[model samples]
Each structure stands twice: as C-alpha cells, then as structure tokens.
Target chain A: MGPSLSIAGLEVRDPRGRVLLSVPALDVPSGALVGVEGPSGAGKSTLLFALAGLVAARGHVRWGAQDILALGSERRAAFRRETIGMIFQDFLLFEELSAADNAALSALFHPRKARAGLRARARENLTRLGLSGTGARNVTSFSGGERQRVAIARAMASNAPVLLADEPTASLDRAAADRLIDDLVTFVRRTGTTLIAVSHDPRLIARMDRVLRITDGTVSGDTTPNTAEGAQ
Target chain B: MMAVWNALPALWQDIVVMLLLLAPSVVLGGVVLRGFAPWPLVRAILWRFRGASVLFVALIAISVGMGIGLLAQERGLRQGTAQAADKFDLVIAAPGSEITVMMASVFLQPSDMALLDGVTYNEIANAPNVAVAAPLAFGDSYGAAPVIGTTAAFASYLAEGHITGRMWATSSEALAGTLVPLDIGDSFTPAHGHGDGADAGAHGGAQLTITGRLAPTGTPWDRAILVPVETVWEVHGLANGHAPERGAQIGPPFDPAYFPGTPAVVVRSDALWANYALRSDFTRDRETMAFFPGAVLAQLYQVLGNIREIMSLLVLVTQMLVTAAVLLGLFILSRLFRRQIALLRALGAPARFVFAVVWSFGAALLLAGAVLGLGTGIGAASVLSRVVSARTDIVITAPLGWAELHFLAGFISVTLILSLVPAVMVLRQPVVPSLRS
Candidate 1:
C-alpha cells in the first residue's frame, strides 16, 4: 500500500537566504491524488523536489514511519529509489538509449538479481502505456506525448508507492495531455498509489481529489473538489 | 617459473614490466565497475557525443603514434649502425680523429686523411695471434656504390662465409655487396671518388668483374664492391703490394718496399685478448691509432641516447597537454549532459554509479585511442625505417618493442587516472539546480 505523508515546517531557501518554499504543516492521506497549482516562480516544482528529498530543506517529512529529511543524501537517494517514483516536466529521457532501456534505467543501480525483474516490469509498463512495439526504438524518435508516456512507464515500472511529478503533461498537446491524464488517473485509482503532481493545467487540476494553491512561496488556499468541507 | 622468467630475453622482460604498469588501472577499473554494467550507458553517452569522442580519440592517437614511432626509429637506427660495424673488430688508422677514421672505414664515408704506412701495416699483419689484417683501400666508386679494396679473407670474414659464388681469384675480379646492383660476370670501370664529383674515367682501363656476392650485413658495406687492394694501387699508378719477383700473387706477404699506403687496416685475432693487446701495442705509437669499432659506435650512441631522452621528454609533455585538454573538453561535455545526469540522480542512481558512467566513458575513448595509436606507431615506424635505410644504406627495422608498449601502458594509466577528474566534476554539480536547468 502507498504510504501517507506528514510534513511540518518544510522550508526551502535560495543561497541568498530568501525562502523559496515554506509549508508550515500539511498532512496527506495514503493513496490520495493531490495536485499543487501556482503561478510561475511560485515554488510549485520546488515543493515537489523537496517532497522527493531532491533539494535541501529544513523540515520533518515523514513518509509512513521514516522521516526522509533526517536522512543523508545517499540514504535519501535510496529512499527515492525504493519508495518514491519521480517524473519530470521535460521527460528527461536519455535520447541515445532505447525506450525500454530508458524506462529500465533504475535497473542500473539495483542489485544484479533484481535487475531482470525490473527490466521485465519496465517492458510491461511500456507495453501497457501504448509503447508495446517501440521498446527498442531510441527515445529521441518518440513524440513529445510518447516520450512522456515512456517517462510514466519508467515511474510506474518501479512500482514505488508515491509518484511525485512536476508538470508531467506540460509539454504535451491537449489531446495527448488528456490521454496521459486518463492513464495517470487510471493507474492511481487501480493501484491506490499516492500521487502528488504540480501542474497549472486546469484540466489536470480539476481531476485531483484535492488541490493546494501556492502564491509567493506559501500555500494560499487548500480545497477539495466539489465539497463544502474543502471551502474550509 | 623463476628460472623461466630469468631466462627470458630483455625484450620479454620489458613486456612484463609494461603489463605490470597497466595493472593498477585494470584493478581500479575492476573495483569501480564491480557488479555494475556501465557499458550500455557509457556506450550511449559516447554515441550521443560521437563527434567529440572521435575527435578526442584521433588527437590522442596522433600524439602517441608520433612519440613512439620516433622512439622506435631511434632505436632501430642505433641497432642498424651497430650491426654494420660488427665485422670490424679493430681498425688501425693513421694518427687522426677516431670518429673520422671509423666513419670513413666502417661506414665507407671516405674523406681526406693520412694513410698508415706499409711498415705499420706489416707490423699489424705480423702481430701475434693476428688472424686477418686486411688493408682497406677507399676513395673509389662505381655508380653510387663505394669500391672497397681489401683481401679475400676480409671479404669472407665480413660475409661470415655466406658468399653466394666463388671469391675473387684475380685483382680485376670483384665481390659485390648484397645490395649492389651488379650481377656476377658484370664489369665496371672504377671512378676516383663518390657522388657526382667522382671522376668516372679516372681509371680508364681498370675495369673489374663481379665474381661473387656477399650476403646482407645490414650495413653501409652492403652497397660496396670489394676488390684486391693491389689492383687499387696498380690502377692509381702506385706499385702493387708485392716485389716484382712475386709474379701477380695477391694477399699478404707483401714486401714493405712495394706496399702502397692504405687508409685503414681492419684487424682480427683468434683470441679477443690478442685484439685488446694489439690495440694497446698499436696505441703506443704516434704514427698510427688502433681502436675498436664497437667502442667508437657506443660513443656515438651515447649522443643519440641523450637526444632520444630530450625527445622523449618533449613527447611526454605534449601528450600530457593533449590529455589535459581532452579532459577539459570532457568536463565541458559533461555539462552538455548535466541534465541527463541530474535526471539519473533524481531517478535515484547513486553518485558512485554516475561517477562510474562518466569515468568509464572517458576511459573507453582513451583505451581505443591508445590501441589504435599502437598500430599507427608501428606503421609510421615502418615507413620511417624504409626512408632511413634507403638514404643511409643501413637496413633499419623499427619493430614494435617493449619500450613502445611501456609508453602505451604509462599513457593509458595516467590518462585513465586523469579521466576521473571529469567524473568528479560531474558529480559535484548540484543535482537539483541541474535538473531545473
């Protein structure tokens, strides 16, 4: 089962000491599909990165019983590998590698005995994500939507409980974006994996179970979709 | 195994040293790459920047090839010159510079110098344990080949009894060196000197016939024509080295009164100790000088050795500079892929795995360049050897040897170590910032 997230006093600062992201307190239920929306430079992506322990932040970030903020960089990386599956806005595929290899990149750091299983799962994910016959094709040749699907396949291949995506569908066209949204929603609903995505697309934000609005490095509003309790 | 190792030749010993030098890099690579298959990622990165990779490899290959090729060529020339002088055990010349006499006599590069008198010649020939003391009469030529006037015994000794046909039976009958473009029974008139200045008609009626050919000696002498010393004197209007009553007889037993002076006397003895004794006894006189050709050649090699050392240093510096530039280029190239690296890090790839990927990428290029450089070095050495042999008539052969291998091993190890700098630099990049960028 996906783990719940508990955050307290999570603050990220630039080198100049100005706060970039300051979340005083937030609690997220296990298997919840949450969305973060904000203006440009409002630290939406920074929040996602801090959630993944990819950036330095002073906070108590507990995913289940383990607090990732207390972990060293190496252990944080291991935490991300074993628990957090991340997707980037730009897709960030290794263009020279085949789609299958790109999706199975996590296998590079996994133990030898687990690598084949990881690769098999990556292939299965790629096939499930509409990349069945394109496993051996170089990702550079993939369309923007297809590339993001490969990215999704990579994230889903690991079977990590928590998926943190930063503008995952930002580069895709509307139709492609809708298809990706459908895929993400279906994957989340079926597997009950906790999904935290930062996006400005209203089509995507409308589908979220709850949304947090950030402005000027602080959350300005929090609301559940179509509910009176969300107004509070 | 120890006995077998001890029995191995010096070249093989050097090869073992070369392999030992490469062991650290191999061991380090094994440790860093343990259980990790970085090759696919490394291969992908190399393919992504194929142009830069190719350019870096080519740069390394050129530098390595030129360095080792020149070194091998230097050694080849040394060995060829040394081999050429192998037959001349001791050269007795008039009181003059030993370098000049050695060059003139052993290398056939004749120059104006005082000749040893018949009395000095007779003394050398009659010395105790003297096996053969043949006078070397120079300053004559046929076409581009030097005409050396010496005894049948000296010709046989130089050829190591590997003569193809019969030895000369008369003064006019000559033996050709292996590379001389003349056939047995061929005849040619003698010129008074070498090159274009040679008087082609100097000895108008002094034609000599080729009676036999000597096997290749890998020396300047390979292009020479050997005839009886008496014929050279007779053609020059000097008395043959015999009394009138000797009646056309050739070779030693020449009466001192009838013996014309010779530029040098090549002396051999049955015992090595006798040769040393002859050199010492002959060195005492102010009239003549006796020296070992090998010793004189060794002195020349010392000078060549110094030059080689300087060239080696220069090559090493140049290679290091090129490697440094390549490493810097690699660092910049890593910047090109910083986003991808950041992606990997974000995907939870360990920093060490990322380090291995970058390092292995650089190392693969270096190793490919080094291996290709070896082939290029050998090819360049062969071409240079042929050019030198053609011009100097010394059959130089620059075979790829342990020295070149040692250089390559050192190059590979140093560059592989330096390659780590780029990998570390890549690792130091801020992962979040890079991912954002």
Candidate 2:
C-alpha cells in the first residue's frame, strides 16, 4: 500500500475563538518527508492536527481515499492506534510509566496484536532507539534528549505508515538536533512511510523533501522537493 | 415487632454501652488503614464508608437495644411479685385442707376467724408495722369489696408502706382499702352487710374513723378492709383468742377484749419467719412453700434460653454476611482500579504477577475491617456487663472467648481472600483499550 494523505478545504479554528488554519487542498505521497513551517499562533500545529484527524475540522481528511472523520471516537482511536504515529509536542508520555513501557503502552492500544507479540515489538523498538537496558527506568528520569529519542521510538514502534510529529526538535542542541533529524529521515526512508512534521527549526526545515510555509490561516509558500536525501 | 419498636428507649441504653466498647478501635483502625491506600483508593474507601457500610453502626446499635430491653423487663417483674408476698405475713383461719392455695387465692375465708398476731383497722394504712393487732370474726363481701374484722394493724399492713398514712390507734377508728378513699371521718356499721343507709343507725353507727389511706403498691393489699383484731374476738365471743391452745405463738392484742393473742395461722407466720430468721432458726410445716426469687428467675431463663441461643446464632450469621459484603465491595474496587493495573501490565509484568499485586491490596483492607469490627463488639460486651453489674444485681458478664475471636479472624481472612475475585478476572481481561486510554 502506498500510504498517502489528502486534505480538502480543511478549516481548523483556534480553541480560543479565532480562525487558526485553513487549506484549500493538499496531498502528500508515501515515502515523502514534508516540512511544515510557520510563526507562533500561525496554526502550523492545527494544520498538522487537522491532517492527522486529531482535531475537529470543517472539511475532509482522508487516508488512502477513506474518510478519516467519518469514524466514531472509539473507532478513530483504534484507527489512530493501528495506522497513525504521533510525536506530540508535550511528548504526552505517561509520567508514571518507564520509557520502554511508554513505547509498549502505545503498542498495546492497538486492538490487533497478541499481548506477547506487542511486548516483543515494544522491546525491539526501544533497543533500536538506543534505549537498551533502560526499559524499567521511569520516563521522567530520562534526560530531555533521551526523552525525545524515547518519544520518537514510541511514535515509530508500531510501524504506522503516516508519522505526524508536532515539533521534532524544538529543544535539541544543534548537533543533537542534526543527528536526530538524520535518524528520523533514515527511518522514514527505510519504512517507505510518509512524514509530516511541524517545526520552526531551520535545520529540520532544510532536511525535508518539500516545505510548506503557513502564516495567519493561509499557506503562504511552498518549496519544491529538496527532500531527505538532499544531504546525501 | 411492635414491642421491639416500643423498646427504643432501651435501645438507646444499649448503644451507649456499645459506644463504650467499639468506638475507640473503629476510629483508630480507619485512620491507620486508610493511610496505606493510594490517594484515589483512599477517596474510594471514604466514599464506601459513608455509604451502605454505615449499616455496621446499626448492627451494633440493635444488639445493645435488645440487650437492654430484656434486662429492664426482668427487673420490673421481680419488684412487682415481691410486694404481693409481703401483704399477709399471717393468714389465720380454721385449720383445713387446701390451705396453701387458699392463702394464695384472693377469695374464701373460714367461718370462725379469730384475733391473730397482727391488728387491723376499718381501712388500710401505709405503716402496717405500727398498727395495733385486730381479730377477724367475719369474712363477707358486698360489691367486690371484702369485709374483715381485725386489729388496726390490718389497715397499716394493707397499705404496704406508703410514704404517708397512720395506723388505727383506737377500737372505734377504721380504715378502708379501695372501697372508700373519701370516708376518713365516717363510722363503721358491722351489724348490717347491706342496707339503704340502715346500718348507720346503730350506736351512732359504731363511730368508725378512717385514720389513713394506703399507697398503691400493685398488690392485693389495696383491696381489703381493716378493724381491730379484738373486734373479731368480741363478735365471735372468743375473747381467749390469745391463749396458745394447739400450735401458735403469742403476740399483743390491739383491744381489751382480746388483751393477748396467739399467732392464729402458725404455718403462714412461719413462712414469713423463715425469710427474716437466722438459718438455724428456720422451721418447716407440712404445708410449707418457700419462694426463692433466684430459683424462679433461673427457671424463667431456662424457658427462654433456647430462643436467645438462636438469636445469638442469627447475629453470627449476620456478621458473616457483613464479611461477605466487605469482600464484595473490595472486589468491585479492585476491578475499578484496573486501569492503573494495566499501566503495570504494559510494563512487561506477567498477567499472574499483576493479579497478585491487586489481590494483596484488597485482602489487607478486608482483614483490617473484620478484625476491627469483631474487636469492637467484644470490647463493648465487657464494658456493658460491668455497667449492668454496678447498676443492678442482675449479673450478665460473659466476654466473647477465643473461639469467637478465631472465627472473626477466619472470617476476615476469607472475606479478604474472596475480595480478590475481581482482581483475578481483571488480570485475564484484555488490556487493549487500557493501554490506549
């Protein structure tokens, strides 16, 4: 399956009673690393949320021609579990749980796998993210850089094709941010998955296949393919 | 059942006794055990405490209520029965068959009654001990009122020791029992039993004066009339009534007509004598009957003991139900906490291991509540028995023994063990949505 995303005349309002974001139409193909950039309150986050079917929007969000909004909350939660990978801005890690458990927790939410199989996949992902021997340590004890890596591991652990991350590296130092970006791009390319990331960081913006700029409820500009491999 | 409701005042007495026993343990245990629970679990425990679990307090209350009620009932009956026995220390009549039961019955006096040890007046008075001895020559009745001739002591003794009232001191003075509360200044007319004011004509109607009124003692004394004991001898012309002819003891007479008198009913006087005399001086006759208050009460208890045993058994059954209730509540709470457990579940914990953690928490609480409840019940029982002993002579002080305590502990263990049912079910349940939510 060529995991693709489509948004048509989608409108998301700021919960603070303001017009936050709008898109006439947009589509991104599989294996594409897309960068979304905008100033604060320019609704880059809302646009990402609208595309991922996380927020209520006026028009349509579809994944491979299936209307995402048409699913009920429970079914939508299941759909999000099985096919959507989210790297939330707050990390939204269960604070009481361990880092490896956070990854496993998300995997267990998918209603499709046997318990043992889900646990093995969770352990494998944590190991792949360099979180080996840290499965039982509380996530709160993990350093911000380590926590960021754990969040990425959780987002990708379930092998969901469409990865939507709010801010990939807003807190990372330049060197670490570069390395994390390289790692995320390599993972997306290896899995042949679509990546939609919202960030204000220039280094991350420069590493994408395409860049779309958002300003005050409008798509202000689009930079044609200078994709993940441009650095290669 | 209406009697049970009517006994609420007594129930209050029981609750006061129970409070003296159980409140200390409940307050202390609740605080200590609550500290061990997680914050959310503590909140849920408090909520349960405020809900149907309040029935525990009611159980203690009902036990105390019924206990106090039974105590009061026994006390009242003893007082009433003793007063009736004191009215006639001696009932002198013609020596005949059926004498003992005749003495017990309110009716049937012999034809030739004579002056006895005690006196009588026309009416009863409170101070029967101070009254002069009179003789009885007649036993007749008009309209449910008995007519007897005896010394002024008849009036005093019949009063049964009321706070006020004087005994008849003169031959002409008289007193009435229930018949005439208003005739204190009236005269007696023995010549006529019934007439339309005709007996009032003789010798200024015998000039009978009522000296005192008797007090209400719920005894047969409130129903007789009194005259000097000599008056009976005078009417019978048996002026030598005081001579100890057959088997009687002599005592002073109230009138010159019978200057000295022998105790007429020797056996009846002996019965009264036995109660007050030294053990060595006690004597018995062929028609003797001794009423032992303690023995009578024991017999009454024997009749009702089986029912009390059954009631206590029922109480035990109820305690078991309460144990079951605790188990049920804890089981539900464990199931509700499964989301927290699922967090642990996803952390690579085996299913059986996750179940053990939840079960341990529930078992601890059930054990605590059961031990506390049982300890409270026993402590209350001891204190209550002591209070009863101090206030009244009825002794009912039996503490719950080791058997009861062991049963209580076992009940707690079982209750807590059973409380883990829901936790086991939760472990086997799917963890998909728990992980997601």
How would you encode candidate 2's per-residue C-alpha lDDT over B64-180 as one tens digit per residue?
A: 333333333333334334334445443332233333323323222323333223232211121223233223434433333344555444445455455245666655555566434
Q: Across residues A187-213, which tens digit of lDDT does each residue of candidate 2 receive?
A: 777777788889988887788888999
Chain A TM-score, prediction 1: 0.95
DockQ of each: 0.75, 0.03
Flag clash pairs in model 1. Answer: none
Best by lDDT: 1
Q: Which has the greatest DockQ?
A: 1
Compared with the true structure, all predictions reach lDDT values of: 0.89, 0.54
Model 2 alpha-carbon miss at residue A67, Å: 1.5
Q: What is the i-RMS of every prediction?
A: 0.9, 11.8
